[model samples]
Target: MSPPGATRGQPAARSRRRAARVAAVAAGLLLALLLCEALGWPFLRGPVERAAARATASVVSIEAPFRVRFVFSPQLQAGRIVVAAAHGMALPHLVDAHALRADWRWGDIRRWRDGAPLRLEALRARTLDARLQRLADGRASWQLGQRRAPPAGEAALPRFGLLTLDEGHIEIDDHALALRATVDLSGSEGEGGRGIEARARGQYRGHDLDLRAHATAALPLLDESEQAPALPVRLEGKVGQVVLAFDGRAAALLTGRRLDGTLRMQGPSLAAVGAPLGLALPATPAFELVGRLAHDAGVWHLVAESATVGSSRLTGDFRYDGTREPGRLDGRLGGERLALADLGPAVGAPGTAAAPPPPGAPPPRVLPQREFDLPQLRGMDAEVQVAIAELDFGTEALAPVRQLRARVRLDDAVLRLEALSGVVGGGRVDGWSALDARQTPARWSVDLNFDRVAIDQWIRALRRGGAGDDPRRALLTGVLEGRLVLAGRGRSTAQILGSADGDGRLLLRRGTVSHLLTEAAGIDLAQALGVLVRGDEALPLRCARLEFGVEDGLVVPRVAVIDNRDSTVFVDGRASLADETLALRAQVRPKDFSVLSLRTPVLIGGHFSRPQVGLQASRLVGRAAAAIALGVLAAPLAALLPFVDPGSGDGPDPCTAAPRSAAAAAASAPRR
Candidate 1:
C-alpha cells in the first residue's frame, strides 16, 4: 500500500530464497553421492557373494573391478565370479564367469512400496563355465542343502524375470548320470511375436547330443484367464545317430504340465538312441517311431501310430509314470512275424548263430556259454501283453511258431510270463514261467506242456543242417506228448542246469524206428531179429515210451521200452548233466529163433556230447544164464510157456501202461 513495487519485490525475494534452498539440498545430495561412489557404499559385493554362496550351497567369490552406475538408474557390473563345488576337490576349478551385470529399474522400487512382486530388468552373463559334481560317497554339488543352511531365507533368493547368457557351459557328474554341455540363449520381442530360443551341444552318457528349442508365450503372463498360460514350443534334437523332433504346447515348461505333442524319431538302432535317454533295450535293433505324446505332471504317455523294430511293425499305446521309483510301464504290443532270435538276447540267449565247430569236434553244450547280465532285470517295473500273429526262427535254427501270445509282468525284481501259448512243431505249446531276482544269484521255475507233437517233423527240423551221415537223423517217426516241470536257482544257464530238479516224460505213439537203430545196436541184433529188420527200411514202431527224473543234474531213467514186429527192446540208464556222462543197458528179444538169433545185450555209455554204443559182456553173460535157467525149467513149465512168451507181452496195447509207469517213476524219483 505504501509503494506498489514493494509487495512484488517482497514476493520475488521469497521466491529466490526457496530457489536457493533447493540448490543447497541438491548440492548436498551430489556430495553424498560422490562419497558413496568412492567408498563403494552399497558394497553389494559382499551381499551378492553371500547370496550366491547360499543359493548354490557352495563357497563363492567375486574378483573385483566392481563398478556401480547411477547416471540413469542403479546398476552393478562385476567381472570373474566363481562358485566352488560342494564335492570333489579333485577338480581344478568349479564355476567361473567372465562378466556379470544386473539392471535395476524404477518400476521395481515402485512395486516394492505397494507390496507387489519384485522383478529385475535384466541379468546378463558372458563366458560362464561351471561344473557340478557328486562324489562317490553320495555327496552332490548341484543339489541344495548339501553345504550349510541357506543364509536365512528370502534374501538369498534372487528373482530375475529375464536372464541372458553367451558362450556358457555347464557340466554335471552325478550317480545317476553324467552330462556336459554348451548353451546359448536369447529372448526378445519382435514384429512377429515374443519368443525365446535356445541351443545346446552336449555329451550325455558318452553319446553326442544336440538340441534346439523355440517357445512362444502366446498369452500374457498376467492375463486374467482361469486357464493356464499356453506356451507353444518346437524342438529338434539328435542323440548319437538318432534324430528326434517335437512340436507341442505346454502349460508351463518348467513344471511340465499339460504337454501335448507329436514326436518323431528314427535311428539305425534302438540301442544307440535309447542309450542317452536310459531306455532299456535288449539288442541294437533298427527302429522308427511316430507317436502322439502327452505329459501330465510326472506321467508321460504315447499313442504310437506306427512303430517298427527290426522287421516287425507294431502299434501300441504305452505309458510311463515316473512319479515314483521303480516306475511303471504299461502297454499292449501287437505285431506280425516277430523273430524269436531277435528277442533271444533279452533272455540271455545268443542272438546270432555260433561259428561252426571244427570237424569231429564235440557238439556244443546245451546250456548258454555267454555271461548273463543280471542287473538288466532290476531296471524297472512293467506289465506288457504281447501278441504276434507268427514268430519265426531262422530256417537254419528251428521250427516256426504261430498264434503266439503272452502276458509279461515284472515287479520288484520278479518277472512272470503268464498265459504263454503258441503253435509249433505241429503241436500246441502252453506254459508259464517265473523268474525271481531278489536273491544273490537268481531263481527260475517253468512248466511246459506239449500236446501231440509230430516227432518226425521235430527230428527233421532239429537235424536239418547236421551231417547227413549222422545215424540219429530221421531215425524215428511218432506223435510225441510230454510235459516238463523244472525249477532252479543260479546265475547262469550252466549253473541253473546244474542245480535243476525236474521230471520229464516222452511217449511215442504209432511210429517207426529207422534201420539206423540196427547199426546203433550193432548188426548182430539186426541179423538175429530178421531180414536185416524189415529190409533196411524203418521198422514198424509198435510202441515206445520213456520217462525220466532229474535231481542235482543227474538224469535217471524210470522206464524205456521200444517194440516192433521183429523184436522188443528195453533200456535202463542214468545220465549226468554235471559231467555229460551216460551209462545205459539194452536187452533185445527176437520174436523168432535161429541159432544166430541169440542176441547179446548192448550197452550205451559215454558223455551225452559224444555217446558210444557197444556190446556189454556182463549183460550178455546174465542173459545167457537166464536162458539156461529157462531151459532147465522148460519141460516143467511147458504148459505156461505161452504166458511168459515175449509175444504175449505185447498185450491189447503197451502204450496203455504209459501213464501208470510214468507216474510211478516220477513219484519214486529222489527229492532234493
Candidate 2:
C-alpha cells in the first residue's frame, strides 16, 4: 500500500510543470515584439501619418483616415491626399491623389543595417490631378519657397527604386507658362531595373503635344565618381507644327552638366516656337534644323550641321555661358539670299495704325509708344557675326541689299552695331550706330556714308506716309553721294528723332530738276526762259551741293545751290522735325532773258504735311543788276542748248569715286 506523504508530493510536481509552460509562452511573445519594432510594423501607421502631416504642413496635408496593411511589405496609406496652399484652405488643393501608398522593401533592411543605401521599392497613386500657379509677385506654387535644409548637414535622400502611376493628370496655369497633360508610368526590375518610363499626352504653349521619356542611372544614383555609368535618356515630342527628337547621355540632374545630345527640329514657321514664350520673332517658313548639343560648367554649345530659315540655308555654331554674372552668347552664322523682313519683328518697333483726323484737320501722326523693358537688356552680353549674300527688305520703300555683313555686340544694355556694311541702290553703304540704355532713358548716335548711289533709286526707296511724299523725288535723277551724322537721347524712335541734332551734305552729279517745281514756285525769269522753249520741258541740272546743319530739331540749309550754264538757283530753308513744318525762300537767275525781262524770288512755306508755293516780288527789289547780268549770260547759252532731249544728263558728270563730304570720308575710314 502507498503512504499518505507520497500522494501529496505528486500534486506539487504537477503544479510546477504548469508554471514552467506558462513562462515559456511569455518569453516567445517578448521576442515577437522586438522583431515588430525593428521591421516597422503596420500597427504603428497612426504615428507615421501624424509625423508626415507635421513634416509637410507647408506643402501638403492629410484629410482622410490613415491605415496600414501587411502584404509583400508593410505599407502605410491614406484615403485622401491634399496639397496645402496659403491660408490653410485644404478644399482647393494644388495636388490631389487618392489611395496613395509607399513601402520599404525587405531587401533594403540589410542595407539600412549595414549603412548602405536604403531604397523604397515602390510608391504608387491612383487618379492624381494637380495645378501649378505663379503669381504676379513672382511667387510660384510649384517652387519650394521655403528654405530646404542643406544636404551638407541633413540625412541622405532615400533612393526611389520604382514609381507606378495610373490615370494621372496635371494642369499648370502660370504667368509665363501653361501646360495640361495626362501621364502614365511603369517600371521593371531586369537590365533596366530601377528605371521608370513615362508617356504623356498634353497641350503645351498652345500646341498639341505628345512626349515619351526613359531615364536610367547608375546603381547608386547620387555617386559622382568616375566609375558611375552615364545616365541614359531620350525624349520625343511635337510642339505645334514643330517636331522635336532628342537622344542623349548625360550626367545626373544635380550634376549641372546637361550634355551630349543629338537634337532635330522641323517646322513650317519658327515663330510658332517663340510666340508661345512671348518672344518677338518673325515668321520663318519651311524651317528645318539639326544640331549636336553639349553643356558643361553652365555653358551650352550647339554645333549646327544644317539649318534653313525661309529661303536661306545656314550653318553656324552657337554658345551660351551662364556660369558667371551677365550671361554671354557668342555665335557666327552665314546664309545666302535671306529675306531680312523675316527678322523684322525682332527689331522691337511698334506697329503703325493712326486714327483719322476730323474734317480737314491734319492727319494724326504715329509714334512709337512701346515701353522698353531694360531688365531684359541688362541681363546678358552678346556678340554675333552674320553674313548674307542678299537681304530682301520686302518693300519698294526700302532699298534692296546685297553683300550684307554685320557684327553686333550688346553689353549691359548698350548696343553697338560695328562693321555694318551693305550694298544698296548700286552703291556701297557703311555705317556704325550705338545705343546706350544703361540710364533711365536711352541715348543713341549714328554716322552713315552713302557713296555714288543713284538718286532716282534713293528717292523711290524713301517711304512716304506720315512724312508725306518726298519733295526731292521731283528733282533728283542721277548719281549722288552724301553723309549724315546724328545724335539724340530718348526712349523711343519718335522722341529721338524730335530731339536729334546732326549735319548732312549731298553732292549731285548730272541730273535734272522738274520744270513744274520752278514754275509753281513762280520764278518769273525761269518761267519766261522755259516758255521761250516750251512749258513741258525739264530744266537741265548740271551740278548741285546741299549743305545743312541740324540743331534743336530743325534742319537749316547753310549753302544750297543748283546750277546749269544757263541759270543758277539758290535756296535758304529750315525744316522742322519737331513740328513737321517747312519755311524756305528761293532765288533764280537766268543767264539770258527774253523781251519780257521779268524777275522775282519765290517763297515756299507750309507744313511738310502739305507744302505751299508763292511768288515773292518784294524780296527781289534790290537785285536787278545781278538779274540783268544773269539774263545776258543765259541768253547766249540758251541758244546752244536744244529742247526735248529726254536723256538723264545735260552737262558733264561731276561725281568721282571718292567720298564727296569730308565728314563722311573720315567716318568711313578703316577701323583700327
Candidate 3:
C-alpha cells in the first residue's frame, strides 16, 4: 500500500517539471517576436505593398530598407517608394519618394481601420515628386480606388502633428479650372524659422502666372490640435497684369480656423482678375486695393484701407457669411467721390474704356444693350449701404450728384436700390429702383421725384463764340419739379426702356426765356429782328409744363405749354423709345399785335442721331396771306385767355391746368 502512493506522487512531479519547460520556451519565443517588432519588421514590406495597392487601386512598390513596426505605435520607413497612378489614369505615377518616414499612435491606426481618417503624429520625406490632375469631367488623379459614398456628417481631414519636406517637386494640371502649375519646393530651417518655401511658374486660364510663398514651420501647420499656434505665412503672385500679395497667420488651416492678414491686389481690370477664379466681378478700369483680411466661423471679412477703381476711391469693411444658405454679403462703403462711369459695368454698361466694335460690326447702339447677368444675383444675398460725397456723371451736360446715398439689396434674385436720395443742380432727388431677375426677361421698375431743380444748372448749354459770353449766363432760368414712374421687363437697360409703359410730369416755375427766342416763337419777324439787334435778354415766363404718357415705349405729350407775356407756345409730339425717333410740332400764339407774323407751325422730325427742324411747308406757303389777315385785324386774343397770367397771386400751374385735349388735337392736326 505505501509503494503505490509514492509512485503516484513521482508522476505528478514529472508533469509539473514538463509544464515549467514548456512555459520557458513560450517566454523565449515571445521575447524574440517583440525584439523583431521593435527593430522594424522588414518581412512586412511585401504585405504592406500588396495592401497599399489594393487600397489605392494602384501599383505600389518599395525598394530595400522598407520596414514597419507595431509596438506602442505604428511606424513606417521606406526607401525609394513609388505609387503608380490608379487604373484608367493617364499619369504613370502619382507619388515617387526616395525616402519617407511616418509614425502614428496605435489608437489612431485602430480608428483608421474603423473608417476614421489616418492621422500621423509625424511625417518626413526627402526628394519627393508628386503630380496631380483633374479632368474636365471632374475625375481627379488623386481620387484613387473605387468611388464610395461620403461619410455622414462632416468628413474629417487627414491630419499630422509634424511634416518635414526636404526637397520636392509638384505639378498640377486641372483641366476643369484651366489651371496648370509647377512648383519647386525646399525645406528651410535656421534662425529665421523652419518651414517650406516654394517658387511656382505656370498659367491659369490664358494668363501667365508666377508665384512665391513661404510659411511657418511645418510642425505647427500640421498640428490639428486646438492649442496649435498660428502659422505665419507670406505669398506674392502675379497673373498676367494682376498682382497679389499677402502676409498672414492662420490657425487650424485645414479645419476652417481663423486667419488674419494683410492683402494687396492690383490689376488691369477686375474682370480680368476674376476670370481665372470664376468670380462674376463687374468689369472695371484698372484697380488697386489694400485690405485686412480675416476668416472666422465660416465667415470672411475684409476691411479695405484703400480701394481704387478708375477714378473712384473707397474704404469699407465687408463680411461674407458662408454659413448661410446661398451665402450673404453685408457691408457699408463710403467715399468722397464715385465715378458713375466706373460703376456702369455693374449694370451691363460699358466700362470706362469701352472696347471698339469689330471692323465690320454695326455702329454701337445709343443705349447699352449688353444683357444683365441675372443668374449671378441668385448666387448670393447682399445688403450694402453706399454713401458718396459726389457722384460724377462723366459729362458736362449733367450736373454731378452731391451727397448721394443709397441702400442696395439683393435677395432671391431680386435687386433693389432703396432709400436713394441725392442732391444735384441745387435739387433733391429721391427714388427707389428694383430689378426682379426671377422672371426670364427680368422686370424693372423705378419711381423717382425731383424737387426744385435749377434748370440752368441742370441742363448746361454748350459755350460758343470763343468764351466771350459769360459762362455763367443762364440760357433758361427755372426751378423744376418732376415725378417719373416707369416699369418694364427686359434683359438690358435698352430693352427695358423699349418696353416701358409709364407717365411723367415736369413743372417749371418762376422762369424766363431768351427774348429773341420768345419773339421767334410768336413768329413776329420785326420783333425778333429788333430783339436780336438789341442783344438777347431774359424774357419772363408765366409758367412752363411738360407732361407725357408712355404706352408700349411710345411717349405722347399729354400737356406741353410755355406761357410768357408775349405769347403762349404749345407743343405736341410722340417720341418712340423703341425706334429712338422723334416727331414734334409747336404752334405759337401771340398775345399782342405784330407788324409782321407768320403763324406757321414749327416741325421737328428725325432719328435720335440726326434731327431736322423746319417750318411746316404748307403753313409757310400761305404765310404772307395769313400775315396780311392777321395784320388787318387783331386776331381774337380771347382764345388764349386761359393761358394768360392774372398778374397776381400764384398763377395757374400749367402742369395741372393745361388742357389735355388741346395737346391731343394739336398732335393729330393736319400737316397744313
Best by lDDT: 3
Q: Per-residue lDDT of 1-672 in model 3, one digit per residue for the tens?
A: 579889889989998999888888888888877877866878888998998787667788988788787776677899888888644578878878888987889787677666666568876788878776666665655555535423222223345666668888877786755768787777853345367787778887778889777875543432334555677877688977789887899764323356689989999787776565433456777889999988877688889899998999888888888778887879988888888888787767777556777787654556677888777777778898988889888876667889999998988889999999999768899999999999988999999999988777766652223223443345567889999999988988888988998889888898787767777865668778888787877768788888888877777888889887767788887777777777888888776666556666888887665566888877676654544565556565433322232222234445567446535743673331
Residues 514-587, candidate 1: write the lDDT tens digits.
Answer: 65464345334435355455555577788888877778877777767777765667676667676666677777
Clashing pairs in 2: 591-630, 591-633, 591-634, 592-631, 592-634, 592-635
Q: Ranking by TM-score, best first?
A: 3, 1, 2
TM-score result, candidate 1: 0.65
lDDT for predicted candidate 2 compared with the true structure: 0.60
- Which ranking of candidates, highest lDDT first? 3, 1, 2
RMSD vs true structure, all candidates:
8.8, 10.7, 6.8
Error of 1 at 446 (Å): 0.9
Per-residue CA lDDT of candidate 2, range 68-141, in tens? 54455666567777665432433266667788776776657556545443466665677666554444444444
Q: Note the Cα lDDT for every prediction shown.
A: 0.64, 0.60, 0.74
TM-scores, one per candidate:
0.65, 0.60, 0.78
TM-score of 2: 0.60
